[model samples]
Target chain A: MTTGVRRRMGVEERRQQLIGVALELFSRRSPDEVSIDEIASAAGISRPLVYHYFPGKLSLYEAALKRASDDLAARFVEPREGPLGARLLRVMGRFFDFVDEHGPGFSALMRGGPAVGSSTTNALIDAVRQAAYVQILSHLDVQDPPARLELVIRSWISLAESTALIWLDGRRIPRAELEKQLVHDFAALAAVSAAYDEEMGALLRRILKDEPADGPFADLVGRIVALAS
Target chain B: MTTGVRRRMGVEERRQQLIGVALELFSRRSPDEVSIDEIASAAGISRPLVYHYFPGKLSLYEAALKRASDDLAARFVEPREGPLGARLLRVMGRFFDFVDEHGPGFSALMRGGPAVGSSTTNALIDAVRQAAYVQILSHLDVQDPPARLELVIRSWISLAESTALIWLDGRRIPRAELEKQLVHDFAALAAVSAAYDEEMGALLRRILKDEPADGPFADLVGRIVALAS
Candidate 1:
C-alpha cells in the first residue's frame, strides 16, 4: 500500500497494523533484538506513530505475544471427524505449521521466559496450553475427564510443546514424522494410563471402538502386535 | 552441632554451611522472598559474615542453584542392575523427592527463569537436563542413538520435567502415582518410537528381553495388549 493509504488508516487499524509489524519482526529474531525504529520502518510508519499505539517496547512485545498466543491457540482447533487419531493428526499439523512459520519468535517466546518475571507472558503461555487442553478434551467428547485421563492429556500437551521447541533447535527430524509420532504418543500415553485405571480403560475402549481398523489408534496396536510376533 | 562447634568450623566449612542454609531457606520459599538476614540468622551467623561468603544475593542464589543442580543430577544415578523400569522408577522417586522437599525453590528454579537475562541460571538448567539425558542414554546402553531414539529420550525428559513442575502446583494427585507414571511415560514414548523405526524396534526388543515379565516395560506391553482384547 502507498504511504498515503498508510497515513489515512484508522486508529484501531493502525494499532493492529503496528502489532502485526512488530510480530513479523519479532518472529524473525528475538524480541529484544528488534527496536521501535525498526518496527516503525517495517510498518511504513514513523517512530512517533509507533509510540502513539504502544507506550514502549515491552508493551509492544506483550501485544505481539497476545496475538501470537491467540494464533497458537487457534491451531489446536479441529473439526470433529472420522477418527480421533486423524483429527489429532490434523491438529498437530496446524500446531506445527505455526511453529514452523514462527521459529525464532516461538523460541524466544517459549524460551526467553517472556520479559523475566513478567506474569503476563507466563499467563499467555498458560492460556495457550489451557486452550489446547480444552480443545483436545472437546475432541475426546468428555465433559469431565478422570484424573488419569487429565494427566495423560496434560502430559501429552507438555510433550507436544517440548517436542516442537526441541525440533525447532535443528529441525533434525522430518516435520511430518514428528507430527504423526506426537499423535501416536498421545494414544500411547492414554493406553498406558488406561491399563492401570478402570475409568481410563473404559475411556480408551470407548475411543478405540470408534477408531477404524486403519485409523492411527489401531495402527499403533498393529505395530505393537507386529513387534510381539 | 552447638554454636561453639560451629564457630570452630574452617573457612570452607563455613562457606558450605552458608550455602546449605541458603538452600534450605530457598527450598521452603522463593529466593526472592528470602533475604541475606534470613539466611544469616538461619545459619546462626551475622549478616556481614554471610556476605563474607557470598558477594551478593544474586551470587548466593546462583551458588544455591549450583548445589541444587548437582544434587538434581545425582538423583538420575542408578545402579546398572535391576530392570530398566525398576531403575527408572527409583530415579523418578528420587527426582520427585527433590521436587517434594524443595517445593517453592524447585518452582522458582524451574519456573522463575532465574535472574533476568542471566545465562548462568539458564545454563544450570540446561546442565541438569543434559545430565539426565546422558544418564538415561547410559542406562539404554546405546553409544550412538538413532535420531528417533534421541527424539524419544529428549521428549521423555521434557515430559518428566513438565510433569513434575505441574504436579507441584497443587499436588492433587498422589506423589507415588506420578512417580510410577513418569517411568511408564518413558516406556510409552520409547515404545511409540520403536513402532515407527527399525532401529528403535530392535532397541526395544533388546530392552524387553532384559526386562522381566513383571518389569514396568513388560507391564506396559501387557496393558496395551489387554486394551486390544
Candidate 2:
C-alpha cells in the first residue's frame, strides 16, 4: 500500500491502535509513568500521529478507560435468559475473568489518579458504576421507597468493587476461592435486599416473571433485574 | 534562643514537624507528586536536615499515613457503654469527622500509588486497613457462628467506605441529610446481619438496661439494635 493510502486508512483503525497500545503501557506502569512518546513508540507510530488521534494524554487515558468500560458493559447487556442469581453469577464471573486478564488497566481506572483532578477519571468510574447500578435496580418491582432501592444498588456495587480490589491486590488467594467467596457474599447480600419481608420477595419474583415488554422504564428495569436476581 | 539551641529540638518535635508538613503536601498533591525537597522547604528545613529525621520520601509518607490512621483508630475505639446502636453511631460519627478533617491525606494514602507490588505506599495502606479492621472486629461481640460475624464486619466497612467516597465526590445532598441517610442505611444493613436477629435484639436490650459494664460486644450489639430499630 502507498504510504499516503496507509496513513489514510481510517479513524477507527487508528483509534483502536492508540487505545490498544495505551492499555498495554498503562497496565505495565502507573498513568503518570507513561508518556505520549512512549505510547507512540510502542504503537509503532510517531508522537505527532498519536496526537492526531488523541488531543492529549488525558483524552487518550479517558478513551482507553471508556473502551474497557464498554467491553464490561457489553457483557452485562448481552441477551441471557436465566434465574437472576445465575445471571448475576455469569456476569460477575466475566468481570473477574476480565480483571484477571487486565489487572493493571482495571486497577488504574478504579484507583484513579491523584495527580490528575477527578474530572475524567471520576466521570468514567461513575459511568461504569451507574451501569452496574442500573443493572441491579431494573430487577426490583417495588414502587415505594426509592431511596431504599438506591441504597441496595449502591451496596451491591460496593460489595463487587471491594471484592474485585481484594482479588486484584493478589494477596495469594486462589482465583477459584475468591470467586466462590464473592458469589456467596453477593448472593447473601442480594437475598437480604430482595426479601426485606416475604412480601417484597414475592413482588420481586412476580415482576421478574412477567416484566412488561415495552417502554423505556420497562427496558431499564428488565435489564437490571435480569442481571441482579 | 541561640541559633544552635533552636536547631537542637527534641526528637518528638522534629518528628511531628515532618509528619505535619508531609500531610499538608500530601493533601495538596499525590504522594508521588510532592518531592522531599518541597516538603522540607515547605517546612522551613533543608532537604538534608529532613533526611536526618526520616530515611526518605516514602518513609515520610508512611509516617504521615500512620499518624492519621492512629488518630482515627483512637477516636473510633470507645470505652464499652450504651446500646449497640448508640455506640455504633458514635464511632461512625468519629469516622465522618476524620474524613472531614483529613480527606486529602487519607485519599493520598489510599489512592496515591500502585495498589500492589513492593512499595512503602502499599505497605502503609495495608497497615492502616488492617488496623481499622481490627478496631471494627474488636467492637463486635460474636459469640457463635464466627463466619457470620466476619460477614457483618466486612459489610459494615464496605458501607462506610462507599458512603465516604460518595460524600467526598460532592453529592448535592446537604451534609446532615447525607449523614442521616448513612446512619439509616448502615443500621438497616447491620440489623440484617446474623447477630442482630429479633432474639438477639431483645437480649441486647435486657443487657443494656440491667447489666453493669456489659463489655465491648454487649455494648456494640445494643448500639446496633438501637440505631437500626
Candidate 3:
C-alpha cells in the first residue's frame, strides 16, 4: 500500500466505520428521526456507498444497537475482588456513565428500538439484561440461584433500566446520587426478599457477611437502624 | 315502546357496549390482532354499524384502551384504614388481578401499544402511571413529597409495572407471592431512599410507625435485623 495515498478501506473496516457513524448520530436523536442520508453525509461517504455496506436503515440501526448492547453489558462487569456492594456501586457508576454519554440511544434501547418488530432488536435488548443478570449471579458466587433470588436480580435490573430512563428525561436528579441509590436499591430489594424466604435470608446474610462497614449495604443497615432511634 | 320486541340500544349505551366488546377482545389478544369485524360480531351487529359508532379500528382501540386505563387506575385505589403495607398488598392484589385477566392487553399497554404512533394510546398509558403515582402519594399521606420520596414512589411504580410484565411471560411465579413481594419491594425501595435523605427518612419512619408488627414493612425490618444477629 502506498504511504498517505488515501489507502482504500477494507470491506470490514468500512462496515465498522459506517456503524460507528450511525451510532454516533443515533446517540443524539432517536433512530427514527435520524435519516440514512444524514448518516452517509456524517460518514463523509455517498448514500450509495453507505447502502453498499448495509442493506437498509433498519439493518444499520440493528447493527448500531448491537454495538450499544455490547457496550452496555460490558459496563456491568467488575472484578470480583471487592465487597459486592462496592463492586455493584462501581458497576452502576459505569452503567450510568454510558447512559449519560448516550442518552437518546439508551432511551431507544430501553424502549425496545424504533418501530420495527425486529426479533434482532428484542434479542439484543434481552442479551444485555441477561448479561447483567449473570454478572450479578457471578458476584454472589452462587451455583444455582433460587427463585426469589432470581426475582430480586431480575427486578433490580428492571429498576435500574427504568430509573435511568426516567432520569434521562431532564436528568433532574444528580447522576451520582442516582447511581449510589441504585446500588442501595439492589440491597434493599434483596433484603426485602430475604425477609420472606429462608433461602433468600441465607443468601442475603452470606452476601452481607463480607461487606465492609462503609459499603453501601452496611450503610443501608445503619440508616435503617438509625430510624429505630 | 314496542312490547315483546328487540329494543334498540341508545346511542350512548351502544357506544359503551361496543367499547366493552372491543376491550374484551383486545384483552384476549393484542389490539393489533383484533379487528373491527370482531368487535361488531361480538356485539351482535354489522361492520357498518360498528363503523357508525367508531370511525375506525384505531379509534375503537383507543376507546377500549381508555376504558382499560380507567379500570387499571381503579385497581390502585385502597381505603386508608389499614397499615400501608397491607393496603399496598391489597392494591397489588387487585393490580395483578387486572394483569392476570388481561395479560396480553397489559403487556401491550406496558410496551406502549401496538404498531401505531397513537398519541391517545400514549396519553392513556401515562394517565395510568400518573394515577398510580398520585394514589401512592395519598397512601403515604404526604402533602408535599420530597424529591427522594418522589423518586422512590416513581421508581417503585416502574418496578411494579416491570415485575408484572415479566411474570406474565410464563406465569412461573405464584401470583399471591408476587403480590406480597411487591408490597415488600415498595417498602424496601422507600427504606433505601430513607437511608440517604432526611425528608425520605422522616417520611419512611412516619409510614412505618403506623405499620403493625405482622405487616410487610415490619417484617422487612425484622428480617434485616435478624441478618445482623
Number of the top candidate by DockQ? 1
Where does model 3 exceed 4 Å of error?
A1-7, A108-118, B1-15, B30-41, B45-58, B111-113, B116-118
Which candidate, 1 or 3, has the higher TM-score?
A: 1
Q: What lDDT score is found at residue B205 in candidate 3? A: 83
Docking class of 3: acceptable
Name the candidate that leads on lDDT. Answer: 1
Worst ten in a row by lDDT for model 1 chain B: B109-118
Candidate numbers, best DockQ first, in rank order: 1, 3, 2
All candidates: TM-score: 0.93, 0.57, 0.88
RMSD of candidate 3 to true structure, Å: 3.4
Model 1: per-residue Cα lDDT over A112-159, one tens digit each: 544745767777888898998999899889998776777789889989
Candidate 2 C-alpha lDDT tens digits along B159-200: 667666556655433454445444444433343332223443
For candidate 2 chain A, the 10 contiguous residues with the lowest summed lDDT are A220-229
Candidate 1: residue B87 Cα off by (Å): 2.0
Question: Over the stretch A33-149, how does candidate 3's per-residue lDDT look in tens digits?
Answer: 899899988888789988988999988988988898898898888988978888988998899988888899778656545543466776677789899999999999987987778
Positional deviation of residue A212's Cα in model 3 after best superposition, in angstroms: 2.9
For model 2 the local lDDT of residue B216 reads: 37
Task: Give the C-alpha lDDT of model 3.
Answer: 0.82
Evaluate every candidate with DockQ and list the scores. Answer: 0.59, 0.12, 0.46
